[model samples]
Each structure stands twice: as structure tokens, then as C-alpha cells.
Target: MKMDLKSKLLHAVLGAFFAAASPVFAQETPNVVFILADNVGFGDMGPYGGGELRGMPTPITDQLAREGLTLTQFLVEPSCTPSRAALMTGQYSIRNGLSLFIIPGTPNTLPKTAFTMGQLFKDAGYSTAIYGKWHLGIDAQSLPSAHGFDTFYGIPPNTSWDSAATVPGVMLSHSAGDVPEKDLIDKGPWIMEQKAGGELKKVKPFTLEERAKIDVDLTQKSVAFIKEQAAAKKPFFLYLPFSMGHSPNLPSKDFAGKSRIGEYGDKIMEGDHHVGQVFDALKEAGVDDNTIVVFASDNGPTGLEFSNWSALGAPDMGSSGPFRGRLGAGTEGSIRTFAFIRWPGHVKPNTDSYAMFSIMDFLPTFAAILGKELPKDRPIDGVDQTKVLTGESEAGARETLLSFIGADLVAARWKQWRIYFKDEVRTGSGHLQLGGADTGFIDRAYPSVYNIEMDPHEDVNVGGNFIWAMEPALKAVMEYEATLKDHPNPKPANVTNFGGN
Candidate 1:
């Protein structure tokens, strides 16, 4: 039948509607908000174990576990910079010549040639902003702004370097008015400012009152950034790496005395509240739907037994939860961490995945989400885990993971079994022993093996039962080493020697 004039016009209008809006509606880019906690232990939160914050219940992270997908076997490097490198570049820290935190006097920096997550998202048409600790590097070219972020406002190096005692002239000009505030607070707050391609400048001499407020300030900045992008109807990536739970654990005044466990518990509780605020901001800005929120700790807890925190003036390192080792060790307790993804409508709520997951997996996973290809010229240790992250498939691409201490391949995890080539125990001394392979060398006639699935703490050496688990791990190392022979680790600047950058 022949259509009348009105019917024909309506059909034409409808066709134009879908044509104009289909791309935006069908595959609109999802915004990403990555929240990272520093050196949080396994049993620190409610879902894992320490959610009560020593009986003070961190409702925020607990609620997130209730609403989002928690990866029970999430893993990261035992330390900071390496974990950051893997999360950003999908490669081991050694591959980028970054096996340790960028010390203040050291000239270490991640090579300029490395591609990063920030660059990837920005290249894919997302506005990227980082508002928190950036320990990767503080050199001329190592700033976050240089690596695909549109804005970089956070601490560089770390508290160890940023303190007034370490950096000369760190304390800003102050008077009696700032003294009372200073008395209440400790340490100075030094903020960094940088444009996408501009110079890196540290805003010196911010008040001591400022240190106590930095976490809150960073949280607000992150929320504002998300709101601004949401209002502009643009996809964005906000990386908020918290600087809490580290030594001299300083929680804001609001959370200072809120926890029963002391400084560390207070800091964790503060972090939990910040997380809740971030999620709240997403909902308030009307971008809750179609947004992917990932929450995880940088690594495991600090020290093996933190019960001495009371006299040491350190925060509660929390329990190892189900694991045995702590930070600084190559044990599961130190490497395996808490992780979750909240992608509305895409990921099922309250889903707990036992599949092996790694911070390195995010690069390829986000690449897949944006329909972009992973870099082909360089080696990418990260496997695409979009299917697992989105809950579409319970099986993920990661089947094995390598645990390291500088150049030492201390432990290797293959499925449920683990093999330890070298003895790695997390102690104050052990962490200090990092930076070389010979530090913790333990030449055992027979390697130690454990079934992680059956013994989460890695207490039972089931090598006799799973005797075959050792070859695959050693084979994995051999195969990886073989590739490096031809690739020859270019060994970027500043891994060890100062002024090397």
C-alpha cells in the first residue's frame, strides 16, 4: 500500500532519530572511576575481614561489596611502584625499569616510551584526571600529566620524601592563626600542579593544617571532576590513589578518633568514607548507570604481624584475612588483595569471582571495553578480562601469575597451585632487603608448593600430592626468560642509580 504524506514524513523522522542517536545509545562509552587504597591488608574490610575497622564498621566498603562484584583472588605486586606500572602499562615493573618506589634523591622514572592507561582512555575520547597520590615518578617527564592525564593534582614520591624533614623548605610561611591549626595537625602538605604538556610545579609551603586535610581535599577534587564531566556529557577516567594507611597514618579530624583500633583503623575508616562519597557523587551527578567503578588496594598489608602497631605509632595493618604473608613478602597475603567492579547492568551485583585476577589485566580489559586494540610492538603481560569483569563469563584469561622481589622470581601461581622458588617472608628487614635477587635466596633441594584453593593461607605444602605443579611454573619462568633474551630488557632510567634519568 502507498503511504500518505504524513506517514511518509513520520517514517523519515523516525529513521533520522535512530541514525543520530544509535551510536550514543547502543555503545556509549562508559566512564571509569578507579579508587585505590594504599597498603590495605586482606582482612581489613567487612567483606574480607576487617570491615569493622576494629569494631567501627566501615559501612562504605561493606556496602560496595554488597552492591558490586568482588574478586576473591585479586592480585597485585607486593609493593607500590611495580603495581602501579602493571596497572598502567600491563607490564611488570622490571620491564619498565621500576621495581621500587621513586626515592626522593633518586633519579628513577618510568621511561617516556611506556604507554599508560591514562593515555589509552584519553586517546579513546575520554577526559582523564588524577587526584591523589602518584608514586610512579616526580621527574620532568614522569608526571601523570605527561602520561595521558588531562589534569594531575596529587602527591609525588610519597610522605617519606614530601615531609618537611626530608625536603628542605617544605614548611610554608605561617602565623599564630595557622599555629593552632598546625598544633592539631602534623606534617606539611605539598601539592603538585601540571597541565597535560606543561611543567611540573610543586606548590610549596602549604600549612601543616593542610596535611590533615589532604585526603578530604583529594576526595572533593575527584568528586568535582566526575561531576564536571558528567555535566558535560563526556566519558571520563578518574584515578584516585589514596595516601592513607602508610606510616604516620593521618586520618582527617572527622575520622581521627572514630575507630577503636587506633591510627591505622582510623585511616582505613576514613578511606571507606571517602569511597562512599565517591560513589555517592556518581549517583548524585546522574552518572551512576553506565559507569564502571573499581575499588582495590595497591598491595597487601605492611609487616607480618602488626600487633606491635600500638607502640610503634603505626596504624593497624589489619589481619591477613585468609592469607598468611603480609606486605614485603612474596606470599599470597602480600600480593593477593581486595578488588571489585561495579558496572551497573553490566556486572551482576553481589557476585564473588574466585577466578584469578590481576591489576595488569585492566589495561587489556579496558581496551576491549572501548573496542581498541592492545599495543602490538611491546610485550603485554595483561590478558583481556572483560568477560570476567562484566560477569558475562566466569572464566577469565589469567591462569598464572608471577610474584617477584626485584629480579627474583620468588613465587609462581598456576591455577590453584603455587610454587615457591625462593623463600620470601614479609618483615621490616625483608622489605629493606629488596632491590636485588640475592637478598632472600633460599636454595631448597625440593621447592615448596601449596594448593591456594584448598588452603587459602598457603599453610599446607601439598607438593607430594601436587608434585606435578612445579614444572609448569618453572617452565613459565623459562619461557618468559627466553623471550627476554631476544627482547633484552631495555632497562629504562632510574631503577637504581641516582641521576640515571
Candidate 2:
């Protein structure tokens, strides 16, 4: 066979073109933007029934539901740090070694080796930036930059809202703000090094004014980052975990009194406005149609002072729709919160799905989108719900979900049944019980079981009569608990009395 050199070269070029175009020819890559609201209730939006939002109304949130898919059965851990940890690792908080609320000085932190959503997306060729709250850990090693984000702007923890006398972590700001020295003071049992320009420096305490300004500056930085990424013509994964609705309900002057429900409601409205700004920025950059926007809360509303004001008159302000219990409890209200996804053309407009999904599902779902494989050796608690979100599947993606309260496995939501291992009303700052004596681990004498589909409020306890029927589900929970001890990651520092205030 005698082939000419020119002909051979032409064939080689054609082959190279086909090989490079294979992926694009098979799939379309979409930019992803995940927006996480802090302590915003399930019913705090117009679509979910929060009454009038801002001044005019919350048309932006409702517009998302009308134009995309709304997840009615989405769930997350009861608190901020645990929820964020589960979300990033695609595993239960216990498995990731972040089982409790990560206090400022807690020795426990998310290990760098663990996989995060940002890491996965970045490996898959997406530019990742995390704006807003990063409550997982405050150390530079635990910052978003180290966790695979190309750019990081925002407060390390929402605990910055706590008085200077209370919290021990520092607030890192990218703009001008007065940071309290105490805020930067790390009374930690762990050591941290800060990296700026290629040099490492030891961080010290700062002020609340500095921390507060950091949040505001981060919003501006986020807007700028999105614009820059869009200009570069690259796919981006922007994880905006806002701190507006969490605590110290400090709404900007413009948003104050915008809502009739007091400071908490005003803060929520402020969060909504920031969300709208992000969307607007995307539109301005001409990436709105190609970006997948997800809006959800880390957990339910906090029963703090400001939030209580809304509870007094506006029941809808912090309502978890038909769910019971608030934040920090094993009840549905604590775990089940607002979740909305908007992807133009791919998802059905104004469509809503009641399929059960969890925050841990984000990593797997994003993996599915990027055609990335999950770690085979590690057990991933999240299921691939990409089809469910894209309107390709109507059935629930997960059959059961294990909810952990600190190190304890307190609740399990399987099918329509939700089993609460103990009865304890979460009060005070910590997600701890209110009464004097501690209600030890499992009050096996009387576990509460509710067919959530029928009694979403969890008012009726069916455990006594349906004990035999729930045996199989209970056995499943026990089996799952046993697997936790064998998790490949090392156990985190035990947090025995961290939450009880």
C-alpha cells in the first residue's frame, strides 16, 4: 500500500478533530451556580408562601419556580457546619469527621484530602469560586481556596455575628473593614498559617466591624468574579452561601423595614435581594440561559431573638411549610427546607417535584453532569439526582436518608416514614435541649415514628403501635450506623458539650 504524505497528513488531522469534538458532540456542559441561604425557612418565599417579600414582592424567587423545577422534599443536616460538610463531601457529616457545629476554636475540621464539590467541578474543567459563608472551618488550610476554589471571598464563619466575647475565629476580608482582634484571635487547639502573595503569616484577632464589612465586600467581589468568568468564556461553579438570615439580623439600611416581620424578615429580604443581584449579574454577562442556578438553605430558621419576632406575628416568615420542628431538632422542619433549581430549556418551566433529595446529593448530581465517576472505594451517601432535577425522572432518587445530630443517629426518613430516636426540644443557641437534665442518647422506652406523608407535622406518634412494622426500617438505621465506625477517614475530635449553652 503506497500512501502519499499529503493524504496521510489530512487523515491524521481529521482523526484529531473527531477525537477532540467527541465530548462536545455527545453532551453540552452547563455552568452551575449554587446559592445557599442561612437559616431561611422553607416557607419564606413567595413561591413557598412567605407573604410579601421586600417592598414590591418576591417575584424573583417565584420566577425561578415558574421557570424551572422546585424540589419539595430536599433535606440537609440540622446546623450550618454539619450541613456544609455533608454538602461538600457527599457523605454524612459523621463520615467526613465534622459531626457537630464547628465552633471557632474546635480542633475538629474538614480534612483537605476529602473531596468537595468545588474540587470535583474544578477537576472537570469548571472555574470555581465560593462567595459568602464558609462555616466548615476558618483556618487557611480549610479555606475555599485550599478546597479547590479558584477564588474565595466571604466570611469564614457565621459565628462572626456572635459578640466579640463569644467567638474566637477571625474574619478575613478582601475590602476595607474594621476586624476585631478578638475575632481574628484563634484560641484553637490547632495551628493555622495564612498564605498571601506566596508568604505565610500568622493571623491574629480582629473586630466585628471588619467581619461585617467583609460580608458586604464579598457580595461585590462575587458580582465582579462572575462577570470576569463570563468574560473568559469558561464554565463556572459559584457557591454563594449567604449569611444574611443567620443571626445578628443585620440587614443593610436599604432592606431594613422592607419587610413587616422585623429584623429577621428584613435580613431574609436582604438575602433575597443579593440573590437577585447575582442573577442579574449573570444576565448582564449573557450567561443566564446556560447556567444552572440552585437556591436553598443550609437548614431551617434559627429560634433566636430576631427570628422569634417573625414568629410572633408572621407565621409564614419562618414556616417550614407543612413540616414540624425548627432548626437544630430532628423534626422535618429542621431538615426539610426550601430548595429550587433553575436551568433554562433543560428543566420544565414552573414545574415542581416532590421527590426526596438531600444536600449531600449535590456532589453526585454535579458529578453526573460532568460525567465524572465517584470514588469507588468510598461510600457516597448522596444519590445521582441529575435526572430528577432535569425533569427526566419523576420517581424519588433516594429510598432512605440518615440524619445525624452531632455523633448520634437521631432520625431516619425512609419512604414516607420518619423515625425520631428521642423527643427533645432544641432551644438556646446550640441545637441542645431546653430542659434542665440531659435526655441521654436514645430513650428506647419511647421512640417517635411518624408517617410524614400523612402527618407531616409529626404531631402523632405511631411508634408504639407500629413497632413491629418499623422493625425492618429500624434495623436498616442500625446497620447504617454500624458502617460509620468503619469509615476510611479518621475520627474527628469528640465534641461532648459544644452545643449546650
TM-score of each: 0.86, 0.81
Clashing pairs in 1: 43-50, 44-50, 45-51, 46-51, 52-57, 108-494, 172-205, 264-315
User: RMSD per prediction, one decimal?
Assistant: 5.2, 6.3
Deviation of model 2 at 465, angstroms: 3.6
lDDT of each residue in 149-173, candidate 2, tens digit only: 7765544442434433233332334
Candidate 1 residues lying further than 4 Å off, grouped into runs, are 1-10, 13-21, 24-27, 157-189, 206-209, 304-315, 425-439, 492-501
The alpha-carbon root-mean-square deviation between model 2 and the true structure, to one decimal in Å, is 6.3
lDDT score, candidate 2: 0.71
lDDT of 1: 0.76
Model-by-model lDDT, in order?
0.76, 0.71
Q: For candidate 2, what is the total of clashing residue pairs?
A: 15
